[model samples]
Target: MTVDHVRSLSSGINQTGVRAYNERLLLSVLQRNGALPGGELARRTGLSPQTTSVILRKLEQDGLLHKGVPVKGKVGKPSVPFDIEADGLFSMGLKIGRRSADLLVLDLKGEVRMQLRETYDYPMPDTVFGFLERGYEDLMSALSIDMRSRMCGLGIAAPFELWNWHELVGAPPAEFAAWRDIDFSAEAARITDLPVHQVNDATAACRAEHVFGMGREYRDYVYFFIGAFIGGGIVLDHAVFEGNQKNAGAFGPLPVPDVQGKPAQLIDLASIRALEVRLEADGLDPRQLWQTPQDWSHLEAYVQPWLEQTADALAIASVASCAVIDFEAVVIDGAMPATCRARLVEMTRTRLSDQDLRGVIAPEIIEGRVGNNARGIGAAAGPIISQVLLNRSAALLGALLHKLGSERTSPFPGRTYPTGSVTGMPRAV
Candidate 1:
């Protein structure tokens, strides 16, 4: 489908777009299952063999698919497997994090090719826009002209009304206020020649998880992302449900008691910023926490209290979340190490066991596979989903995939908690 048709179809699908839909269906099959012969694709997609052949030819001609090694069949002509052209399309992701800005480029298979990030005390309009300008230029210079032209669109992930949290992050009100009047996505589109999409930072992270991480298995789950602040997103019926106001997973504002037994939002107790506050009081540099997961090794003393409170808050939130939605799992990830994530999951489960879960089918707490990279990766997927999958009438195909789930090995396997494996979360049944 042309870009114009893709844009129009994103609003809603219709009978007229069935061809585009079939194309996306076949592509998605190849994406999830690696490679398969045309007849196999036809059977898997329930499309007529002739229709599958026609679509395969067109996709090959369009440079989106290619024939792999021929395999000797039991009888008749040898079958040739077709696979996706990873370089067929590309999307850019921009994450306007509270403390930093990250620009990333992802190919068709969702692999990062180029990334740029910079940290600042607080974001200002000029500074953010300038970073986008330079980052875009650097990315383009590194790509061949042909590859650059194949760019699909750009997706920006940031907390909405970020200026409202200036006090929490210790930023000057005026400097942060500049964000209130600025449309970062519009500015990004102006800086680049690609169409732009925007979503809440946490939601973007959840999107990444849905598309590239656990969504490959579980279709219904509650997501919690620990950044400078704790944020959340929900995936129901195989898609991220943003709710009426686009804040379905805004778990930060949930009421929780602080250390002093005073009421406070969950964010105040469960965020990395809370840990940072404690570290600062102990005369330690807080920047070390954001550098990488490994830097948090010696922080057991400071992180322990936050962990106890965070586990309690998460347990309460998860129980309440399950009472309303029959989620299959609760995914937790953040700017911390795998061990740290495992410990949090371990504690949350312990706390959850103590809660009065009557009338609620409690969800299993699972560590997110995406971790700190979710927002950037998920932000990168927004435009791809909008311009590719949703734009085509491929909602049927998406539903089918959701039912079938990942047939191949998972990206992070055998690391689920309770079992004490550090590799990844357990596969959801």
Candidate 2:
């Protein structure tokens, strides 16, 4: 994630050629460091002043960079800093969870411009894609023609091996088996001409935290996203790192000690779904757990005990991950409200103190700020960062695409035209 020096590159945005690596390098610097004058940008990227000025002008004209307030220095001309234009581009993030789904628009600045959510017992094909079709229309209709034109692509954050969780979600065998053949990225591509990117849902949350939340504060950390099932993502050298199969921080299966000193999977003890099971066993309305605009204060009595157990499991998982990476912090986030996140973080810290750390240096436990909306927002970031901005994971995405047989390096990757939304695309019976 460190910005290294690259020298002598020239390719204007208007010209019919590839976007210069130098330009993305400059954009990456501005993105990480905020507004800086040409000289400062040059110093940061190791580009000469002339090259920096030219790239800045091209990016500004291309609607990617904009001028900031002039700052008078101790000497010469009052230099104007250049900032990544917040409205310069737009992308969509779709988070497909077992209990609900969300679609959102993200600007270059990592802010959510618009979002829509739907809750369901389980994700049925028609229901999921029907919601997507409607959400895409509604979201795109709300955008100005210019904004719509600026739409980059769609990114999907879905759980890994979604079909395998049918039993846990109480779905019928037939309905659950349908998920085995679902290629979310391809299905999404049917609606918008924009290139579609897919990532593990928890990793998407981690990406959001890295790009817009606490990621800037630490270079190496393990992130846990407490959703229907507890999951995690890894950050190495400041970028979200998905390993060879794109499942590096799959923490659900991580071993933790139960209250009886018996071994258990982190998911068994740490997930929100576990809480729902607790509520159901007590004859409380479990659906309330998945409701949007969530305030678990209503279920405070039930939440307290769940919180304690989840915190204990999280503390152990945090230590186990840090033991391998020597991470500086364990950044914890979830598909829950800020209050819940705060309590979990506080409790985790306390529980962490109780773990037997004979050899490993326990990492600092930090609360995530992105909250429940993180997976969707992180999904949105994938396309924008792949096309407009720069990230270390960009290379991983390229490799992934290559494995899928596409070397997409443009605004449009494989198919360069919008096919428009159809009721359905290819599927198996």
Candidate 3:
């Protein structure tokens, strides 16, 4: 069936109740893991083979999924896998950074359809919202996608402190004038008129990496994102664990010991700000240092010490975190290019090898494949995933309620009703 045809049919099922939930569950699984065979879907969802077949047929008929070519196996019958129709629905992702904002239009399968970057001289809250709304509108217009019913919600990822201002105030107490008091979600929602989901940039990167990158290899791992600031996300049991207030992975403020045994914050010692300061001290322009060969050579002279100290601090944090969370490995990510990621991974691995923490398995620190687009793309995927999950949960509950309602006997001790009875009480005993 054609993608548009399926979308139209599924649109009918949007408020059709219980059936919509089953479709959402199927779509959610596909969104998270790409294409998969019906049997695998059954395995993951704990639905019967017959039920899986029924749901798949309905989803395919509705145009939410399409059958891919059969893969020839060495032994048994070729399993026909199903994949999401990328054109079926699209969502927007906005990554708000200190220096720039990135916007991406993503499909249901989390593929980037279009991207735009805007750098800011100074990002005031109001101006940032204005730029974001304009960028979103421009992208939608460029794609020629109809805003009504076709567009999913917008997802945003910003710096941890900016995103979770309330939490920081209770703990470390940041002094950023602009971030001291703000309702980002309400402001953005008012401007865009689209439901906005906000997540920390590092947390969003972790979600992107976990869903689409090398993070699938291990269930429990830490995703370290190194950019202007150093931050990370924790993945436990293959799920991103957003703590009680949805602020779990703020790696910047985690404490580490200095040479004099004084407590130093991780961001203070390991961020790009530190790198820039070191370069300036060595009589090199930080911007030129990143661009020039001679400056890189001079920069590399300081890289070993910088990397060593950074790795040491990271190792300390890792050990402390593992003592509590017991993650299997730590995956490093961020705006760093492939080569830089490799270097950081190597440095972290070497530092881990030298540490003597008895009876604790040292996590294998590795590079993530998602790169700089991790936060942006992941932010885009958020609303799509959330909508799918919410729809599924509501559907499942409706189905359970239907089944319970059909069963005449009340499970409660005080209630019994006659056949075709209007009152919920027993008729004249």
* Most lDDT-accurate candidate: 2
Backbone clash tally (model 1):
1
Candidate 1, residue 428: the lDDT equals 20
Ranking by TM-score: 2, 1, 3
Question: Model 1, range 1-429, lDDT digits (tens) per residue?
Answer: 333333332222121223465687677667656789998887666667898999899988866789999999799999999998877777889888877788999887778998988787666778877898888777866776556656777888889678899898788887778888887767886677567888899988888887778766776899999988999898876667776666669889988777687888889889988888999998998877777435667889988888888998898889888988889899999878788888999999999999998999989898888777789888888766665453211244344445545463333464211211111111221
Model 3: per-residue Cα lDDT over 1-429, one tens digit each = 333332333222234233354567667677657789988887666557788899899878755689999988898899999988776566788887655678888876667888887764334576677787677566755654342244667789887656344332222334345664767678766655666888888888888887778876787888888766787788765567666656677888898886567989888676665666787797876554333122344457766676667777777877777878678898887564466667778887887877776877787787898887898987887777666542222233344445556444544456432222221111211
Deviating ranges (above 4 Å) for candidate 1: 1-19, 70-79, 259-261, 292-294, 391-429
List of clashing residue pairs for candidate 2: none
Cα-based lDDT at residue 371, candidate 3: 83
Alpha-carbon runs more than 4 Å astray in model 2: 1-18, 394-429
TM-score of candidate 3 on Cα atoms, chains taken together? 0.77
Candidate 2 structure lDDT: 0.80
For model 2 the local lDDT of residue 227 reads 90
Query: Model 2, residue 390: what's the lDDT?
Result: 53
- Between candidates 2 and 3, the TM-score winner: 2
**Candidates' TM-scores?**
0.83, 0.87, 0.77
Among residues 3 or more apart in sequence or in different chains, the pairs in candidate 3 whose N, CA or C atoms overlap within 3 Å are: 6-62, 6-63
TM-score of 1: 0.83
